[model samples]
Target: MTTLFYRKIYAMKTADSTEFYVVRHGQTAANLQARIQGQQDTLLDETGELQVNCLAEFLKDAKFDIVYVSDLKRTRATAAAIMQYHPDTPVFFTPELREWHLGALEGRSFAELNAAYPLLMQQIRQSSFDAAPPEGESMLQFQERINRFMEKIASEHPNQKILLVTHGGVLQRIFNLAVGVVGSGNLRPLCHNASLSVFQRRNAQWQLAVWNNTSFMHLTSANDTITL
Candidate 1:
């Protein structure tokens, strides 16, 4: 029930811009338990199913030219719900959009990770963007992956509407990129499960249009450490 406001960036609409509608996958049992999903391919729980069904109906009339989804089950399932309304749109499932690889931290709660991996927990506490968990990606690596995917899409789909179904980590990173947020302690936009965030890339610049929109679901969402 707290309200957070990020610095908004405004730009003139151009013919070369691409409109992006980004959706985070719905709630999962892991999310409810505060467990780290991190590419674990968890399925949607009942609440998640209902959330997506509502979201699907809300976006049924959007004129998206193409759809891109993370290959993870949660995102795929969410996208499937929405895609039923856009049956002919081209949908591409790619691992490039997967959540941050959490490695040994996967499936463990934050409390459990603090107990099991003190050093890793300390690194995270210190906001070590370059530090990675055992067998996982660093924050920097995750950001780079998102950057590459975004650049590819912006380059390839100018003047087109895109529907991107992916993880909250990706959406969080995109929010940071758009608003020039750096370091730690700054408030990040809340990424509710099954929420929709909109962005536009015009002349190679990213502008955030909407964020953390869950009005269609008509319900508060669960949060997890992995998703922020």
Candidate 2:
């Protein structure tokens, strides 16, 4: 694993300032099956619903100025769960926050895809952000899309606390670009279900405040386990 370190050039901002809390949705059937979902729409399972409910309870007392979510069902469901607590906050949906398009690998189990296209799989594992799957969007395309989404969020909610429900790949790219950790040839490890990550902007520059924070789990039932 790569060791990451950042210098704290500024103090953490108050809650009223522009703060981004990113969340990856709970697990879906595809995730449980270990299949590549890409752009394919998948619904969250019972465990996912419970996880989101736990997240909702955790945020019930917190305040948010705006909420954003991917148009995909999984993200939408997670957003809806969060909205149960912050019903008055506006929720915006955008496709730009969707997962990386795995193209021909979509809906295929990882084992099957590796068995069928071993060379392609190997290339993808070793490729940089410009790598493309057969008939799929390149990493560059995904970066552009994520950048646009981040720009829109920053422009629209410059000084408000904003929550975004999105995919793992989307969050990974955002973290990479925000902290100048680009082109590392690998995405950050997958985000756990209902995990919360925080980002802050200061003086016109963005910095990662937290990454893959699972503390929200404390709000859930002691027996609760997020399986995604």
Candidate 3:
């Protein structure tokens, strides 16, 4: 994983209203095999179930007024586990929060895709700012939708604590939006499975205070959440 930034636990008055947690969905069978899921309705494997369960335990004390989840099974399962702790928090679903649609390359492995679309793959390897995978959404399309979603969240939930259970692709956009670079290049923070990231709305600006943090989980159980 890229160590581009460090984690700082930001704390504010209990009355602070603009705080949210972005959690990546847990591991899936495709993830273990190194295949791209791309909006696939893949179920969480046994490991995923365990990962979210542990995460839910760690967040048992957290208070969220609302929860948002991608319209995918993996994210839904993960959110359900966490919602167990926050029974009163209402969960909402939206396609805008789904992962990058891979289209024809949905179930392909990285190596297979590299061999097939060598140049295009390499160009987008670092940043997926301008690559189209068969019938997949273009970079422009992806950016537009994500920016719209970000705007909605910022506008709708002021000074309220919320949670988003989504894919790594969506989480990357959150990082980009925080730094005021929504669709420049492939500028995104590494988001681990079931990892928790945090942001705050201070002075009317979004700050990416925490990136890819899983310290809430026990050391042993957290091993599955990280990538090599």
Candidate 4:
């Protein structure tokens, strides 16, 4: 969609509200193979490059005051593509915006992991609020991290437009937080690669303006929520 469309739909921003144009990073080989990426720093695959190119074109005319990107290869690449339009826009690379650190399970395919760690896989699939991969952050810890980062940014930049390039898990956490979902056992729509989601913070409250918008990509691909 065009930037004009975005402005029309989100025209409620006041002098104190903050707008967030959040984007999940493009695809990777792990995404196609159903592997857990976590903090692996995987590069984008061929299709991922094309997806981000389309996304960059779609957002080329959007105005952004600042940009926040996850300190990972996939997210960085995606952010780079989009920031080409706003060369002078200040960008911050932070690990706090990175994917849930799956630790030892970072490189394993879903089927392989399920075969070896059935109970853990079950917990992950069920979205057990406390379940975590070996040596990884639990669902609670991840949620806290995301909440802290979001609060910090919103407090720092009022009445400004911000662009956030992160991961699917982070997007999912943001959605959960916006909807008052404390724990797991709740179903969420899949966050496709290179999808765009928008949130607005007004009077210290965050509201979802859009969710899982992939119209720019022309096609949708695997998301981190995929499972066998």
| Top-scoring candidate (TM-score) | 4
Q: For model 2, how does the per-residue alpha-carbon lDDT over 111-193 read when each residue is reduced to its tens digit?
A: 99989988777756653675678888987788788888787778778787788999887887888767776663755554676
Query: Model 3: per-residue lDDT, tens digit, 1-228?
Result: 432344444454235447878889988999999898898899988777778887788788887878889989999999999998888888899888999887888888989999998976775565667777788886657767787887788679877888889988888777777788844366756677888887777666778767787665563465555442
Write model 1 residue lDDT over 4-105, tens digit each, in one string: 332232232358788888999989999999898898989999878888887888788788889999999999999999999999999999999999898989
Ranked by lDDT, top first:
4, 1, 3, 2
Instruction: Give the Å shift of residue 40 in candidate 3.
Output: 0.8
RMSD of each: 4.5, 3.7, 2.7, 4.5
TM-score of model 2 relative to the true fold? Answer: 0.87
lDDT against the true structure, each candidate:
0.81, 0.77, 0.78, 0.82
Going through the candidates in order, what is the number of backbone clashes in each? 0, 0, 4, 0
- Per-prediction TM-score, please? 0.86, 0.87, 0.88, 0.89
- Best candidate (score: lDDT): 4
TM-score of candidate 1 to 2 decimals: 0.86
lDDT of 4 at 159: 86
Q: Which runs of model 2 end up more than 4 angstroms from their true locations?
A: 1-17, 222-225
Question: Which has the better lDDT: candidate 2, or candidate 4?
Answer: 4
User: What is candidate 1's local distance difference test score?
Assistant: 0.81
Predicted candidate 2, C-alpha RMSD: 3.7
